[model samples]
Target: MPRSIDSFNRQRLITSYFSVTLSITLVLFLLGFFCFLVLSTQKIANHFKEQVAVTILIKDNAKSADIAQLQKTLSVAAFVKSLQFISKEEAAEKFSKDIGEDFVTFIGTNPLQNAIDLSLKAEYAEPEKLGEIKRELEQNSFVSEVIYDQSLVALIHENVNRIGLITLVFSALFTFVSVLLINASIRLSIYSKRFIIKTMQLVGATRSFIRRPFIRLNVRLGILSAFIAMLLFSLSLWGIVKSYPEFSILVDAWILLWVFLGILVMGILISWGSTYFATQRFLNLKTNALYY
Candidate 1:
C-alpha cells in the first residue's frame, strides 16, 4: 500500500511539472508571434512605399546632353532609389497600349514627352518630402513638370500609420497579460516545494543558501521553455515562407535572433522574480499554517 501511494505521488509531481513547462512555452510563443507580426507589417509598408514613382516630363527642346546630365544627377540623389529614362517614342508606345489605341498613328505625331520615372526610397516617400523633391526637380532647365499620384501616397501613409498604432497598443496589452500568466505559472510550480523551503530554514540554512538551488532550477526551466517556444516559432516561419515566397524578403535572420533572445530574457526574469517572491511567503509561514 505504501509503495503504491508513493508511486502515484511521484507520477502526479511529474505531470504537474510538465503542465507548468507547457504553459510557459505557450505564453512565450504568443509574445514571439506578436513581435514577428509588428516587424513584418513595417517591412510590408516599406515595400509599398518604395513602389511609388514620380514622373518627370522633359522639355520638348531639351538637349540629349542635358537629359543625360539630369539622369546622372538624379541617379546620385539621396532621395532616389532608382530611375528609368523613357524616350518620347517609348512613352507613346506605352500610352498607345494602355489606351488600346494607336493615337500616334491617328494624329501622325506623338504628343507624349520624354520623361524620367523615378522611385524614391521609403524614407523619402512621404507626401511632404515628395512635394519638396518635386519642387527641386522642376527648378532644372530641362525639366518641364514633375507629377505623381498624390491620392495614392496619402492613402498609403495614412494606412501604414494606422496599422502601426493599432499594433503598438495591442502588443503592449498582450505583453502585460503574458507577464502575468508567466508569473502565475512560476509561482504555482514553486508552491509545490514550499515545505522543502520551510524545512531548510528549520535546519539553519541561510535564506540565500536556500534560494540558490531553486533560483538555479528556475533559470534552467526558463531557458528550456524559451528554446521550446523558439523551435515552434521557427517551424511556423518555415511554413509561412513555403506558402508565400514573397514573405521571404521580410524574414531577417538577425531580427529572429533578437526575438529568440528577447523571449529567453523575459523567461529568466519572470521565473526568477516569481520564484523569489513565492519562496518568501513559504519561509514566513508558521508551522501550523502549512496545513492550509
Candidate 2:
C-alpha cells in the first residue's frame, strides 16, 4: 500500500475507535444517570415511609393494664417499625398545645381518649399494609376506632406511583435514543475496516474468525468507554454534592460501584450488538463490492 493510503487508513481507524468509545460513553452516562435518579427516588421513598406515623386510639373505658399489653404486643409485632405509648393525659396535653387553645372552658371533664402513636419503618409504610395494621389494632377489645389520615396516605401512595411511572417513561425514551447513537457509532467503526474484512472473506475466513479481532477490540473499547462514562457520572455526582451537601449521605462508594458495573455492562452489550451487525453486513457483500 502507498504510504499516504496507509496513513489515511491508520487515521480512519483511530478516529473510528474514538468515535465508538465516545458514543458508548455517552450511552452509559445517560443510563448511569437514570439509574442514579431511580436510586435517589427510592432513597427518598424510604425516608417518606419512615415518616409515615401511625396513631392507634384506645377506648376511654379501657384499663391501663390492657393498653400497656397492647403497646407491648405492637412493639413486638412483625409489621411494627416502632411504638410510642401516648397516655390519655399526654395526648390531651398535646392536643391542647397543638390547637393553641385551652379546653378547660369547653370540657366539664377530661374526655381525652387513650392512644398509642406508632411509627412504622419505611418498608411497612404503604397504604394497604397500614390499613391492615389499623384493622388488626381495632380488633382488640381495649382499642376504639383507629384514626389515621387515610386521604393523605392514599394521596402519597398515588403520587409515588405516578412519579415512578414518569421516571420510567423518561428513562425508556432516553435509552432508545442512546441505543441508536451507540449502535450507529459502532457500525461506522466496523465499516471503516470493510476492505480488510473483504480481504479476509476472500481467503475463506469463517465468520467467527473474521469477527474475532473486532470482538477483541470491542471488549477493550467497552472497558475504556465504561470508565469514561463512569468518570462523567462521578463528576455529575460531585457536582450534585457541591450544590447540595446533604446529598453526600446517600452518595456512598457502594452506590458508585453499582453505577460502574451498570456502565460496563451497557458498553459491552452495545459494542457486541454493533459488531455483530457490521460484520454480517460486510460478510454478505459481493466480491466486486470490495472495490467500492
* Candidate achieving the largest TM-score: 1
**Per-model lDDT:** 0.89, 0.81
Q: How many backbone clashes does candidate 2 have?
A: 0
Q: On residues 97-202, what C-alpha lDDT tens digit does candidate 1 reach at each position?
A: 9999999989999888999999899989999999999999999988999999999999999999999989988988988998889888878877888888888999
Error of 1 at 281 (Å): 2.5
| Pairs that collide, model 1 | none
Evaluate model 1: give its lDDT. 0.89
Give the Cα-based TM-score of candidate 1 against the true structure: 0.93
Q: Using lDDT as the measure, which candidate wins?
A: 1
Q: Please list the Cα RMSD from the true structure of every candidate, rounded to 1 decimal place.
A: 1.8, 3.5
Estimate the overall C-alpha local distance difference test score of candidate 2.
Answer: 0.81
